[model samples]
Target: MARELTTLVTGGKFYEGPRWHDGQWWVSDFYRRSVFTVTTDGVETHQFDVDEQPSGMGWLPDGSLVVVSMKDRHLVRRAPDGTVGHYADLSSVAGGHVNDMVVDDRGRVYVGNFGFDLMGGAPMGPADLARVDPDGTITVVAEGLHFPNGSVITPDGSTLIVAETTGAGFVAFTITDDGSLVDRRVWASMGDVPDTTDVMEALGSGLPAPDGCTLDAEGHIWFADAVGARVARVAPGGEIVESVPMPDGLGAFACQLGGEDGRTLLICAAPDFFEHSRSVADEAVLLTMQVDVPHAGRP
Candidate 1:
């Protein structure tokens, strides 16, 4: 099947998270320090200066906007009254920055941090993942993960599947009653990575790094590649069933399946390597295409 790219909100800043909310798509442009809303027609990008690099996004039961402040190492909640409050100070647990997150229906946010700084071009990450409680308490849910990036929960909320970005794979954990991970194991491994990047030029090697991911109603896991420029759909058995080719042939960062019917696939891409330029999406847009299934685990 073929998919078409539609530009929704271009030429403002670096856009990352694209989430469907309140009848429109809300996204964060990290470099520009703004949050925006784009109509489904891919036109009219409105900016909200957030004063921080907001990456991932989610909503609370009370309809507050939960944004990840990467530079400040904090999770911020934007209340309906227009006040932004600190939900969690992740600096004590986050080694680098708070990148992306997945919030369950119960309002629990699971966030990931950069284990090591890669902007200097090095394979130094094995970032850890942490859970932020509703009461704003933070705890390390799992450790020794190689750059846990985008994540999703099962339809029943029984398991949390996470993408190991720098590690080139994914893992799953049984969520206990208390919100801790149990029975941790690799959900998927892309393959072994070799040293070749600029970081490898310094530290001597590179990693494949699967970045962001989502799931389908049938339990298929879909992931975006950092350098691969492809989105892969994997079956529950940990086998890749189909691969969606990205046209740009560059770093495709993240993706989510959304639409009125939940069949339109949305892609968030950086025109080039993000670490080097630290730029935003001028055409960082919302690309759409109809699919055969609806998104699973909170799109």
Candidate 2:
């Protein structure tokens, strides 16, 4: 079914890590080096600045905010009183720039990285997924993942599904009682992905490069097809049940389902993912569309 998307806001420099929290839509603007919260009617307010560039975000049980500082490979915590401080540093374990993350109900944070110097044109390689306990202890839970970008924990908090951008599918891991990941398996296989390190070649292999995503109540995942210029809803067996195309010349990069009823699908889009171009232009935007199934599970 075709759904119309409304432009919620504009003039961003590559928005990522979109989330719905505390009755507002929060997102990180890469080149802008700041995080902003937007109202349903498109009013934007700068929440905080991350000098190293911010990516993912989540909240603790006490209402404190944890944000991923990309370049420095650190997690910054913002207390309810507005004081910001370092929560944990992953530089010692992260192979590259740490990116998106998901903080579970227990305040355990699971984050991923680039695994290589992506912007520097280095060869693509596997990276590890790190888990940060509530006490701020970091551990490499899983290793050798193909660029884990966005992730989601099941409503029961028993499973974690992560988007493997270059792997062309979603990988699932059983979350143990102590916040460990086990029973690794493929949740969705998009296509026969080529075993190549070239980003363009991997993207052009006719497989969906799933980026940031959110899970719906019906057990379907809505992910941004990074190079496909659309957001696609995938079933467990790798079936694309629905897809929403982006506006002309733009590509959807990340998405989240939120709003009063959790039916609102917020999308982050830009002309391309090139850092050079996006860092210099304000072509990024936030788009919204209403869907039938409401969101379920963690961010």
* lDDT score of residue 160 within candidate 2: 97
Error of 1 at 124 (Å): 0.8
What ranges in model 2 sit over 4 Å off? Answer: none
Clash count per candidate: 10, 0
RMSD to the native, candidate 2?
A: 0.7
User: Please, what are the lDDT tens digits per residue for candidate 2 over residues 1-299?
Assistant: 98999999999999999999989999999999998999999999998999999999999989999999999999999999999999999998898899999999999999999898888988888999999999878999999998999999999999999999999999999999999999999999999889888877888888899999999999999999998999999999799999899999999999999999999999999999999999999999999999999999998
TM-score of each: 0.90, 0.99
Kindly state the number of residue pairs that clash in model 1. 10
Query: Which parts of model 1 have CA positions greater than 4 angstroms off?
Result: 45-47, 194-208, 275-283
Candidate 2: C-alpha lDDT: 0.95
- Candidate 1 RMSD to the real structure: 2.8
Q: Each model's C-alpha lDDT?
A: 0.74, 0.95
Give the per-residue lDDT digits (tens) of candidate 1, residues 72-104: 888888898878777888988887878889888
lDDT of 1 at 83: 86
